[model samples]
Target: MRNKIITVCTAAVMLVMTASCGADKNMKKGEKFLAIGEYYEAAIQFKKAYGKTPPKERDKRGQRAAKLARCYDRMNSHQKAIAAYRNVIRYKQDTPETHAALARLLLKNGNYKEAAREFQTVLDTLKGNRLAENGLESALTAQRKKEEGSRYIVRKMDVFNSRRADFSPMFYGDEYDRLYFTSTRNEAEGDELSGITGTKNGDIFYSEKDDKGKWGKPQTIESGLNTEFDEGACCFTPDQREMYLTQCTSDPAYPRYATIVTSNRTDAAWSKATKLDITRDTLSSYAHPAISPDGEWLYFTSDMPGGKGGLDIWRVRITGAGLGGVENLGEPVNTAGDEMFPTFRPNGDLYFSSNGHPGMGGLDIFIASPDKKTGKFVLEHPGYPLNSQGDDFGMTFEGPHNRGFFSSNRGDGRGWDHIYSFEKPEIIQTVKGWVYEMEGYELPAAQVYMVGNDGTNLKLSVKGDGSFTQVVNPGTDYIMLATCKGFLNHKEEISIRQTDESEEHVLQFPLASIRVPVLIDNIFYDFDKYTLKPESATALDELVKLLEENPNVTIELSAHCDYRGSEAYNKKLSQKRAETVVEYLIAHGIAKDRLTPVGYGKEKPKTIRKKLTEAYPWLKEGDVLTEDFIKQLDKDKQEMCNQLNRRTEFIVLRTTYGMFDEKGNLKNPPKPAKEENKHDEDEIFDIFIE
Candidate 1:
């Protein structure tokens, strides 16, 4: 009986020893895989070792769990990482680093409250740890952001997504009907799996919209662009002539580094991609390229030195040669945590993904729009549905529309980024303006300076068609000044009222010609009489405002006759009309000596203008409306020509009106003040610190 009991004890002891040895072997294998950056394999090995570790050996089990959590974190298995980290905490292995890592994972998993607690714990232990402080701030903000939903409607595009990761979508071609993205599906071009991701190497896959505007099956770009090495995030020049792509070349013995490469467009496929020499800094990783609206700069993400964060958005001047002068975006745009995947809208708004900024969770998308007043970029977040507790990034717009596609990992616990379409049903409150000469065609060379009560100071560049459209906020007042080289300046002030729906207001700027007579339309008088009509009050008021706007200019206010009445009667009536205008002007604050009333009665005939020729195809420009010419015209044409001849016009007599003193000698005029929009020193300091 004694021998039997001893034998059982010996057998149990041997079994225990065997399990311990296996766990140790598994741990060593996991450490080896981790050293080589094979996170997926390392995770599997670590999980096995953790399962084999005995519950009685809490220290050993805790260490194994910690390793497993780290591996899962690297692999982006957020849910799994959270579970493993909880196990580490349960086993009393709660180091400051472990708490920080656990907090980050919880934050990524949408457990904002838990993340905040853990982040606070980390901050308490590791005093002044910027990463922990930032995480805490993010966690607290995530709770509020999650509660406040956004206007953006987001939905997964399953047809364009795969079981594995798919992300970084770009709209291509003229119609933006073609979509190109990176994927790790089974059908990816490469057979070899990434050491870092444990999935097939990323390849650039694309889909084209059919005649019905429906997306077709995604196809891999199987040219030299896709190799066994990972290739992803890509952008094109505005002209779409050249493509910039992110490439990660792996070495079995060392860690992989991401670098940007350029490919020239060919007739069929992209030419072989060549590495871009953005400085000789091979040690830093550069990825996620975006071209500015004017193609003057190349914006990308990098982990180089002098950045305000772990990964910062950097830009380099794009010259005829290679890139010149690399600069960090700095401060508010870059944070202690990672900021990656930069994209742009046609209006020069920069969109990017960040973990450092206060957000809903994970890598939330943010916009950095330039403040026209301060010349600084202001950050904004599109809350809720557009952003989630999962990694959301890689946004692409269809031209200037707000509706577009982005990548998110929301419902996928595996953290595999999938393409999701997002659209903010536009509440487009805008101001569309036309700046032109008073009686001539549009002035395309004009420039408009705008100032809004909401601290908006924008220098608007007019389109070739002499039009400008700008989005505006509700209940704001905007003042705009239109200026052209050969025309007098015109100013308009508008008040945008708050409304329940979108509205577009139109403003017309008719700058008076400095070299020619500007006919004032809408001025009315009694039939064959000199008495001013009540409707003429509005038109005369407008002229009064114009005169006040250009205070230094003195004008010749003239009235003409229609050549129907006798020359003496027409001259006498025209003289009375001119004097009436001068009297109204003097009553409205005009200096008496500044006005020179002229009566041109049937002597100077009117010539057809471009606008008139367009309105009446029978009439051509340079055609004069003389008495004989009017006699040959039809009844309607004769009346129109007669109306054109009986008009009131103003031409600048002198621009230096008030520059002369009573002595007739020229007095020095106060230098025209230069108006510029600049931020005060305190505002700049706040921006830098922020």
Candidate 2:
């Protein structure tokens, strides 16, 4: 009987010790998992421990719930995490961290009113809690803003419900019709898990819009490009020939680094992925690649050292050789808060998401432009209808259209992520066309001005291809004018109907040839002087108007000397006269290239010398008679002779026409024959001789 009792007691002691050892082992395992960011597994282990413990020792239920809340929050289940946090506070006394987390989650879920109250509760209960106090104020501010309506709307919401994390979205192709995103779904090829989060794995997946404008089912991007570790945050060149994406390596022995990998799209399949030499630090993580339209500037996000905060937006110059280091965006674009996911529009506007700026909650998409004065990107929060009180980012416009795609987890009831399309308001019609001289030459640097019926003039410079485009509101009659210095002005008028989709008007302006003499409309000069008088300013003004009207026309200003003077003296005098005309044009802001001076020196007279002599029989050929000879003759004779020679004229030397071949050479139109001058019976020319 004694031996039996001893054996039973010893067995009971051993069992108790084993149970304690197992309990301690589980606690350590849970702690280890949580330390490595495997919150889900830690929560599971904690739950098991809570379940197996006796009711007296089951106070760990609240702790397990807290752990579960953390896991759910990491998974972006803000609502669920909020509920779990509530349970934590209800069962275990309210903690500052719990209250703060709840308030944050509530704000992110767009429960601003409730969030404000929860934050106030934290301030009232927790002493010396600055973070909670600030959070409460932020929540209250958001509530006030919410009364004005959500800064952004959640149009369409869908979720990708993989067992692992899904993140980092990018648009590709000209139409932005296809979307590429990273997912840790079961379709990933590698069995290896992330060392940081211990997630199942990651691979790139593509979803494309179909004919009906609905997203087709997502499929993994084909072989050699997507590995088992992580492939995400992709950006494509504007031409869609090359793709840059982020790849995460899982080996802990090697420090964690997110490398930029590239692939070429050919034959409808991506080529084998090649690693880029963009990784500078072994511990730093670089991801979320965005290439500029010209593919010269590359923007990305990195958690490298010397960041303003957690993850900052960085950029590197890219060329055919490789990336040229990296630079942080700094300040307003990147704060102590994380900023990532950058994209550029076709118009050179930059759109990015950030939690650093003052926002509703979580990450909100913001826009930045280089400040004219500061020479830095001035970040501005996209207010009302573009940013909600949730994580709103990863936006890309659909081609050149205002329709865009972005990801949000705002009022969407589904716990999974879905792609949403944003349609911009249509308020104007865009006009596009080519501007050319009469001779088909692509006129670069031509000024295009649009005059509204109300006389509002908007000026735009023509591209190298002589193409100009502008956006004008409907219900406006626009007079479009193209002008290049020295070229004949071209004008067209269009009345845009409200129902017009887009206006495509091709305008061909025939510039007068440079060598063709054009009569100076109102220029009046003294009989033999090259100096422009005060009265000549009016005529010079008219010339200025003509030059302004024809920006691309290059002209030669020539002066003729009368047949009486020696050829050499006449040439010198004519050159001075032409130079005077050129000075007048230049003073009126006409570019020098538009004006060339030449002294015809009676060589190319409008009237034959014999005809002039026949009209007025000069007494002697070698007679160097001055103004006295003109006075000796009748006023009519001298005036007629003077009018024939003392004149300044313009001839277009070069006319630029739009629409050139690939070589960019000027194309001249066939010349028309000179028309016989018809003397109108009503036209009269009165000549006055002194």
lDDT of each: 0.86, 0.67
Q: Put down candidate 2 lDDT per residue, 208-238, tens digits, no spaces.
A: 8888878777788766887667777788875
Q: Model 1: per-residue lDDT, tens digit, 474-567?
A: 8899888787887877878899888777687899998999898889888788988889988998889888888877777888999999988899
The most accurate candidate by lDDT is 1
Clashing pairs in 1: none
Error of 1 at 556 (Å): 39
Compute the lDDT of residue 230 as modeled in candidate 2.
70
Instruction: Please give the distance, in angstroms, between residue 383's alpha carbon in candidate 1 and its true position after superposition.
Output: 0.9
User: For candidate 2, which ten residues in a row score worst on lDDT?
Assistant: 681-690
Model 1 poorest 10 in a row by lDDT: 681-690
Cα deviation of 670 in candidate 1 (Å)? 28
Winning model by TM-score: 1
